[model samples]
Target: MAGSNFGTAAKIAAPLVLGGAAILAGMHRWESQELTVYADQLAGGLPTYCSGRTQPPRPVGERLTQARCDAIDAQTATEYGRAVLACIPADKLDQNSFDAFTLFAINVGKSAACGSRAAQLMRAGNREAACKALARGPDGRPVWSYASGVFVRGLQSRRQYEANWCLTLAEAP
Candidate 1:
């Protein structure tokens, strides 16, 4: 029975690892798919399009097909996943950690994610510490909990989720 349960669990989890399903799901859940370009006040009024995309901002009034938007998201997620993987060894990363840090890099930037205390702990092979660092700074206040100089409840929630996700597969420090 235990073996069968293991098989069932593996079947469910395999696709997530193979297709980067965790990160994709997080992106879709948090970044609503938008067909038209608009200014994202959360992103400091940067022009955005197609599921929170800001790079090479799409001109206003331009619309994107669902397929195009999905493609862009997949491409960006892959790029950010690679950046996160560089901080921690692939062998040490599970689906949860991969999702957590990849989502973090996608929300923030590659440079910020790569230079964060979380990344530093990951580099030092302390997965638990890295996970804890995602939510709280040295002063214990939530990290990445503000936008445009104002506290954002949504960001705080996201950070808390990410930190919890990071810890799911990590061993205790």
Candidate 2:
């Protein structure tokens, strides 16, 4: 009877494990979509922002092919993901947190993101504080503030989104 009960438990657990994996995969896919949309909005598709040389020198402001645009977008997302993974501890991140950090890093650059107060807080296991810290720049000003003291609406909106993602309890995607 004990052996039969163990087999029954295993049967139940197997489905649960598979279901959890499916859910995680779905979450990752959704997160990737969100990142692409946000990045496309930030970086227009007009001219390719290629880091390396292309076959033909694609000058700035020149229109890119649809295929080229897609390739660049995908490349940017991959680079940002790699940067976030390299800078942050794996155990400290959830999907939303990772997404938020990725966006922030993309905007502010890897050095700033890695050295941020939020990163420190996260490393110390203070997620709430880390979330709050996302609103400010490296200079301690609101992220929207320019070096000349002007505030940009777009930057403000982006910071708000990042903060919301950081603070929200729900998993992203």
| Best-fitting candidate, scored by lDDT | 1
**Residue pairs clashing, model 2:** none
Query: Which stretches in model 1 have alpha-carbon errors above 4 Å?
Result: 1-19, 170-173
Q: What is the C-alpha local distance difference test score of each model?
A: 0.76, 0.53
Model 2, TM vs. native = 0.60
lDDT of 2 by residue, 77-171 (tens): 55665676677765566655666776677566777888888878777666766776788755666763342456666666667778677676433
The alpha-carbon root-mean-square deviation between model 1 and the true structure, to one decimal in Å, is 6.4
The local lDDT score (0 to 100) that residue 128 gets in candidate 1 is 73
- Which ten contiguous residues of candidate 2 have the minimum total lDDT? 7-16
* lDDT accuracy of residue 42 in candidate 1: 91
Candidate number of the best TM-score: 1
Give the Cα error of residue 75 in candidate 2, in Å. 1.6
The positional error of residue 16 in candidate 1, measured at the CA in angstroms, is 9.5
> Candidate 1 at 137: error in angstroms?
1.1
